[model samples]
Target: MSAYRPEFEAALRLFARASEAMKARGFPAPILVGGGAVELYSNSAVTTGDFDIVTPRQEEFEGELKQLGFTKPVGLGHTPLGWVHPELRLGFEIVSATVLNGMADRDRLVLIDLGEDGEVAIISVEDMIADRMGQYASGTAPEMLEQARQLFILHGDADLDYMDRRIRHESGGDYGVADLKA
Candidate 1:
């Protein structure tokens, strides 16, 4: 009776496995980011076909993924860093070597316990909303605005002040969390 959708649960399981392997290998755990964080914070109202993760130790992280039965498909036009677990049929990309390009507050990262599946680190809801706003401000996609709005509306417990500062930083003061409230 897990509340999570199948896709999200699978992603979490895979992330936990990879993270555990990385820890065993003496590497920093990966930070789940992008659409995966959105899906988690949005209660699956927002869904992504793949997960995006950030880790300073990409080489070691990929090695751990390999040990966990993930493979980079050959000649499939996938990004060099994209890896898929065939059984799960879901893939993830190592989007960046640094977490949120080093703009994120490491203190704000949340750890989700997956019981025996281990745990995964995710960006804070405040940071995620700001990230979406940043994407919208950068003209990446109009949907990014809607994603920010969705997260804002869903997480009432989110710290407005923190989000405001993060939004200003991410958007270069072009937008703020207050704008999403409007």
Candidate 2:
């Protein structure tokens, strides 16, 4: 698994352009939010084939594509990787308050250097665990639980206590260390 890989250096250029576009236009952070954001680090989710850019005040542009709880403008020039730039599109997803809040306080997230190629500034694993909980909170997917368990088993760092607290808070019960693999 090429854990947490996304289109590299070009995305930074695009981000700068997008950020500048937003700033110059008096928009907010113009943050990146969605699977692309998460895949910047974790191997859990991969190339979602789309980019999710969020802004406070949005004006629809032509060629906007809306799906997966997101809206993107239509006919943005494509990258070599064939992914679209959302800023060029009029489509903007109205993201959750939590996501917007997280983007505001970007320092809370973790940054792992993917290389000179590009660094991975991903949401912290703790937040990743918490955020993903919404999908499986209803006991719908056993595989989802397994993925969480695997994440803890392999990359849990030394903060078992912290992981446990998050698990309890989101999962609604303690699986206990016995349930976790050594």
Candidate 3:
């Protein structure tokens, strides 16, 4: 009954399986971040070709991925350390050992229940917007600003005070929560 794209659904299912496997092996579940989080929060208004995750235990996580049939590309042409599932054609990359390089508030992390698929943890909307703002402030891409605006507009109930502090921290005060409205 969910209106999410097939890719998104598949990705979540895969993430759930991986999380369960990791838990069974005594490793903490990986946190979903980057474009995957953006796609999820955007309600498929945006799409990412790959999924990015954060986990302190990279090697163990990769092992779990391999057990899940995600294999590393043979050559250096692809994303280093990224794994690709041949049949699903989905790529997964572990972007960082810590969530938002440890800048994000642990209390703000959102846990989404997938019913039988288990649960997935994602960065809060405030942190995601702040992350985009930080990317824009760094002169990396103007699109990040637009994405932040879209998220702000869509998530009207977002905590502005938290966003303000997070944006200031992420952008080094180059951008603020007010800027997201602009």
Candidate 4:
């Protein structure tokens, strides 16, 4: 039997527990952002501790995580090598403030299952790519050039042109993919 992907399992456990707790008190599931959602959409990223979820306005969920026993895990240190986004240390970036509220619509977001555990919120793959390109290139990671390569190679058919454009426009270095080569 296949074992569980630890990174996914751990993140899912955190997300699902939070979702359940929030619903017990009544709040919408948080919108999943970052690499795992990207892989879920583009079908590329390896299992990683790089999952990041965001709510349009991160209020209720932040309170819920506190209630659910997640006490804002501070960064222990930088993540060791051979992992996903080699920068930004893994863990929740739960925000308890109202930022970017009333800007983007809630309808465009897609829902992906975190197993029978329940649903997880996410933005569009195109949007994820666009967001990655926007300001947090590689989510401020220097080693994410590898993920760009995989995304372009595996999901090339899904959004080759968009990925190509984004990589060239945003990613600061070579992706090692021939078609994506500048």
Candidate 5:
């Protein structure tokens, strides 16, 4: 199976540029999260319609994104500023924190180049799955449960114990260790 998707490529390219620009300005690279992170970690087994980004440095990061041609904000006045790529027609939502399966800290981030000009910061596969599971439990994005299951089936190496803890925590025991195994 080929993990090739034009949307994924374009999003990564934009993210890499934004990351590099932020670093050039002495700001930390934001961690890629939500569906976009799932798409990358799944090798494109799943794709996202929008990019969900997390960083404490919202102002600085938005400035970098603006430099990369993401000028028009698209959301209805939200904290997580939304933008549409003028050329690619892709969308980006930048937030300061991860509401689902939040990382312990930025130290958990890993940088991957994906053969691109600059590397992108991403959460671990375990964290990404837990994030999906959190979404599932919330009843807001039940589709994430399927995304989580697909990612687990595709990767086959995520930390089960860690994933279980996150699922149980986020689901408040409504989902348990058995749920993770399933």
Candidate 6:
């Protein structure tokens, strides 16, 4: 069995439950994105307490989570609405769409069966790396450089060419995998 961190496992469970609830109520499932997707793609090598998801219908998605016992917690800073599980500290950052730092629609989503009518949708590994690299390039987050480097070293199969193109395009030729490795 593959090992997952406790925080990720909890978030996956919540995502599964939320997906089922939304489907029953006629809502489309949200695409799992951001750092949580990194954790999932990296097989928990990278972990976060929060799950970031993007969907066309944010209000409906959030409503479903609220109906499923997730509450909007305060002091999370600028996230529109930060929902948390009643018992666990797991947080959800539901957003309108995939933020286009780069690597848009480059790969397919991988679904993980969580058992019982719950399936989790994860962003592609390429896109996940793009997300991290985007953060690194923007100078908003210096630590994302290390995260991108770790992902590059840890996931050998990740497409270096694609990542290089994305980093250059999004950063206006400022950064690349070479920078991460150096």
Best model per TM-score: 3
**Model 3 CA RMSD to the hidden true structure, in angstroms:** 1.3
Query: Would you list the rank order by lDDT, best first?
Result: 1, 3, 6, 5, 4, 2
Assess each prediction's global lDDT (C-alpha) against the native.
0.88, 0.44, 0.86, 0.51, 0.74, 0.75
Residue-pair clashes per prediction, in order, are 0, 9, 0, 1, 0, 0
Per-residue alpha-carbon lDDT of model 1 for 1-182, expressed as tens digits? 17669867986887999998898878888999999899998888888877899998888888888888889987767767688888776788889987778988899999998888898999999999999999999987878999999999999999899999999998999999779987
Residue pairs whose backbone atoms clash in candidate 6? none
lDDT, model 2: 0.44
Better of 1 and 6 by TM-score: 1
Candidate 6, 35-93: lDDT as tens digits? 78777766788778788888777888888788778888666473546888877787898
- Distance from true position, residue 102, model 6, in Å? 8.4
The residue-by-residue lDDT of candidate 3 on 1-182, one tens digit each, is 17678877887788888887788788888999888888889998888878899999889888888888889987657877688887767789999999888989988899888878787788899999999999999997889998899889989999999999999998988889889766
What CA RMSD would you report for each candidate? 1.4, 7.7, 1.3, 6.9, 2.9, 2.6
lDDT of 1 at 68: 81
Best by lDDT: 1
Candidate 3 has an lDDT of: 0.86
Tell me each candidate's TM-score: 0.94, 0.50, 0.95, 0.58, 0.86, 0.84
Q: Which residue pairs come into collision in candidate 2?
A: 61-90, 63-73, 63-74, 64-73, 64-74, 71-91, 73-89, 73-90, 73-91
- Please give, for residues 132-155, the per-residue lDDT of candidate 2 as tens digits: 443356567555455455445556
